[model samples]
Target: MKQNPTPAPIKINGSNIDLGEALPRKIQDELAHVAETYFGHLNHATVGFTRDGNWYCCTINVQVSNLKVIIAESSATDCHKAFDQSLAKVGRQLLRRKQRVADSRRVQMSAAALA
Candidate 1:
């Protein structure tokens, strides 16, 4: 069994709002897990939150590898909900990228086998 590498530290920034205890540890853990599970390592991650009127906006930018960068944003009535939405979006993007890479490799292997 191989162990996944530690993920990069996450940087959080807030605008027009006081984050104070709002960024949940569970969400950070989930983000780290996603990075490790998808790419085994994370080069960098930045999460920014903004408040506009009654809505909260969350943006997450994650660099999983030299060739991959995932960015997602969402807006909701609460910061936590916005963050969760952004996380989910980023997870889907990462999964799709992984699937695409796997599919390309599989195709290449099959082509080579036929040659």
Candidate 2:
């Protein structure tokens, strides 16, 4: 039987900045979608925002499994924009990581078998 895939949990933290009430929910939804698309299921994700002068720096950390963790970061004038940029980076990283993991687990045919 096939089982339904659940989105990974996400935690958001902002340092010296107000994330607004709805932005957090929106961010969570978007992050969950991205995580689900690439990893099927992940342990969890953490997003941190910090204001550096005029730019907002956003950092995203995704725990793909017990041993693998992916991190991405971006800086922009707006926190949302920074997050969007970082999320894009995360998606790319996740795809590459998935490919590597899949390749590593694939069984290779012995030379004798091909002969």
Candidate 3:
């Protein structure tokens, strides 16, 4: 069995925000798995948490490729919830990208077969 490489630490930027320490380990593991399973390689990831009057906002930026960047954000009552939501949003985007590539390949194959 082969072991997976560890993911890079997420960078958090904002004053008066300590969400980085509060980030759930499960979410971090899920993000690492997403990188390996979807992107095939780990890229840089940045997570930012901010607080408004009554809400918390989380923003995540993932660099999938040299020209492709995935950004996801969410606002919730707390930092952890917002962060989880943002992670899920990013996962959905990655899934969509994978599906698009697979669909394109299938279409090309069918076209070639009919040619």
Per-residue C-alpha lDDT of model 1 across residues 16-88, encoded as one tens digit per residue:
6777763757567888888778878777898999988999999999998775678999999988899999999
Q: Please report, in order, the local distance difference test score of every candidate based on alpha carbons.
A: 0.85, 0.85, 0.77
Tens-digit lDDT track of model 3 for 80-112? 788789988988999898888889999999999
Model 3: worst 10 consecutive residues (lDDT sum): 19-28
RMSD to the hidden true structure, all candidates: 2.1, 2.7, 3.1
**Rank ordering of all candidates by TM-score, starting from the highest:** 1, 2, 3
- Which candidate number maximizes TM-score? 1
Measured by TM-score, how close is model 2 to the native structure? 0.83
Residue-wise lDDT of candidate 2 within 18-102, one digit each (tens)?
9998879888888877877876666888999999999999999988655478899999999989999999999998889888777
Which portions of model 1 miss their true places by more than 4 Å? 1-6, 22-24
Better of 1 and 3 by TM-score: 1
